[model samples]
Target: MSEVFERYERQYCELSANLSKKCTAAGALDGEQKKQKISEVKAGIDEAESLIRKMDLEARSLQPNVKAVLLVKLREYKSDLNNLKTEVKRLSSGGNYLSARDDLLESGMADTLTASADQRSRLMTTTETLNQSGNRIKESKRTMLETEELGVSILQDLHQQRQSLLHANNTLHGVDDNVGKSKKILTSISRRMNRNKWIIGSIIAVVIVAIILILYFKLK
Candidate 1:
């Protein structure tokens, strides 16, 4: 498990470094190159998020104390990734809206034609955004299912432990009952032995007293 975590950590570090490099280079690039770099960074961000989620699931299998520590580190990594993403997004979007408006205005087309073209462009963009959202939703559903399975597995373990504890408790109760019976038997035996001792001592006293009376009568 630790090995898996370390593997993910290494992958994340490489991805993060690559994203940083791209983000830095994005500023120096022109036109298509800049857009391509931004796209790559976006892809890297998705991968990083996926890797972090995997790490979170892996952490669930660890001991609580260890999981807690790992989760803290993962959270920090997530935050760092978010910052990188923010930087990349800002770089990518800088002047993008203005550029789009300028292009639309400079197209030298009729007003109605520009409006129609802009409407089509906006529609395409919305469609693509919706598709991306759908994909994200599916991914989220899959992650939820996996988490549910893990929860069920942990619950099963707890159920088994509960059964074991109950069995142990029953066994202890049986032992206690047996001990009580043994103690009662011992008490009965002790009482009987004491009564026998008293009877024997009384018999000896009677015999001695009768012998003295016999001698006394004979002497008289």
Candidate 2:
């Protein structure tokens, strides 16, 4: 079970790192390149999710106690996976594509706008494309902000869990210490009782001997 969780964690980290690299490169990439990278990242994410589902199923088939930790870790991995997906979508819809499209439109308009009728038509088309791109950019920004907020919430939850675990561990340590002290006190009491029993028995034996000797002397 631990091995399966480790494997899942390794895959998750690899996918996340790869996605991070692609996101960094996305801004520098041309539209076609960015699109290709996005597709590849999406495929990687899908593969990771498939493996996670397999691991989750395996965990569920185990005994309840054994499955509990795995289930918790799996939940965390799922949250991270969601964050990664949001990041990839944001990177894939970056402003680079919009900027490139605008550049192409401007170049084309400059070349064709020598004729007044062509200029008017080109201007209308360019304006519509710009407006559409702007709307998309706005939507993407909104989505990215929402995703960021969710990621922050997940981090906070994880932090709280860590703190709770730490407190539980400390409590267990205190219990152990108390148990050890109790054992020592019991051992001391047992030793004292044994010594007192031996002493009392010795004193009784001596008194018996003294009485027997006195009776023998008096009778003789």
Query: lDDT winner among the candidates?
Result: 1
Model 1 lDDT tens row, 46-66: 998999898888888899998
Give stretches of model 1 more than 4 Å off.
96-220
lDDT per residue as tens, model 2, 156-186: 9999999999999999999999999999999
Off by more than 4 A, model 2: 1-114
Query: What is the lDDT of every predicted structure here?
Result: 0.73, 0.68
Best candidate according to TM-score: 2
Give lDDT: candidate 2, residue 95.
Answer: 49
**Local error of candidate 2 at residue 124 (angstroms):** 1.7
Task: State the lDDT at 11 in candidate 2.
Answer: 61
